[model samples]
Target: MADGAVSINMSAEECAIQALADRVMSQIADLFFAQHITPTPVQQQMLVSHVRAMALRSRTGEPLPEVEEALFEDISPDSMTLAQQVVDLFGNLPVEEAWLLSVHFEVAKNEG
Candidate 1:
């Protein structure tokens, strides 16, 4: 027998949760783009940089520290309240959707 570890695939429920997380992150990105608050190139770059970082971190086993940090940084005079509203509006989605939303929040936290 080989010494390598065996790999086990995720269940259907796990897959759904992963997909949902992606959707939530995409939704947050869409919301930010729609608001047009990112007026400068630097700002856009910042957002994208954060998103990428978050995505990479997700692949690893990092906790939600990045998420919290991003939220705190991004919650400014113009967009903070809107972000809060968006969170409230979509907070109580179903389990799958909620998972997606959590993913988005994680991404957003990293991005901000």
Candidate 2:
């Protein structure tokens, strides 16, 4: 550590996790453009952070927040579909991850 400075080191495992999050976000950004959804900078950041946290949860087997019982049943179909596609890109994430992302997409659209 330098004088008057604090240093934080990320492990190789952590680096890999962050890389996965970045890749997922990059692809999702392309998908958003293709789907004609313009994500604001705030939306992009929010979504990226959400994916990173979710990835950590899945990789660590941490309990994720439960989605509603209805889950995708009640959300906008387009957002749900978009979320499913994005989640698919993340590998074997729980379907609840998709539903959570669908809510994020739906909210981001309205807010953007």
Candidate 3:
């Protein structure tokens, strides 16, 4: 999808993925604020980029299975659930991607 392209021109698959990513990011900001967490400007920007990359990978049907097992323990149920919800937005993406999203959230939570 090139810049300035009209919405009607984009295919259904492209639209769906874009919608999912948009919603996921919006919901994430809501969730973060609801939890009384104030992420710094840099943290917010980083998460946006991370989510965009993850969305691209998911949409393109690529795989990312090189994460460390130790990272699992840091992912709380709440984080995992949020990650799953975000991942589900892009259809049946690999579970590893969800876990990776959880890792991102966990890191964000642990940060200032």
Highest TM-score against the true fold, candidate: 2
Assess each prediction's global lDDT (C-alpha) against the native.
Answer: 0.46, 0.80, 0.76
Query: What would the TM-scores of all predictions be?
Result: 0.38, 0.84, 0.69
**Could you give the candidate ranking by TM-score, starting with the highest?**
2, 3, 1
Model 3 lDDT tens row, 24-101: 799888878886666678878887887877777777877776877576876898878877877887776877777877
Candidate with maximal lDDT: 2
Off by over 4 Å in 1: 1-8, 36-74, 93-112
Higher-scoring candidate on TM-score, 1 or 2: 2
Candidate 1 per-residue lDDT, tens place, 1-112, comes to 2878787788875565556556645766577677643334554555445444444334443444323345354334344454444445434422222232343344444454
Report per-prediction Cα RMSD to one decimal: 9.2, 2.0, 4.6
Tens digit of per-residue lDDT, candidate 2, span 4-68: 78767899878878988888888887887887777778887788889998768656777776667
What root-mean-square deviation over C-alphas does model 3 reach?
Answer: 4.6
Better by lDDT, candidate 3 or 2: 2
Q: Rank the candidates by lDDT, best first.
A: 2, 3, 1
Q: Stretches of candidate 2 above 4 Å error?
A: 71-74
Model 1: pairs clashing at backbone N, Cα or C within 3 Å: 20-100, 21-100, 25-104, 70-109
lDDT of 1 at 111: 56
Q: Give me the displacement of residue 91 in model 1, in angstroms.
A: 3.3
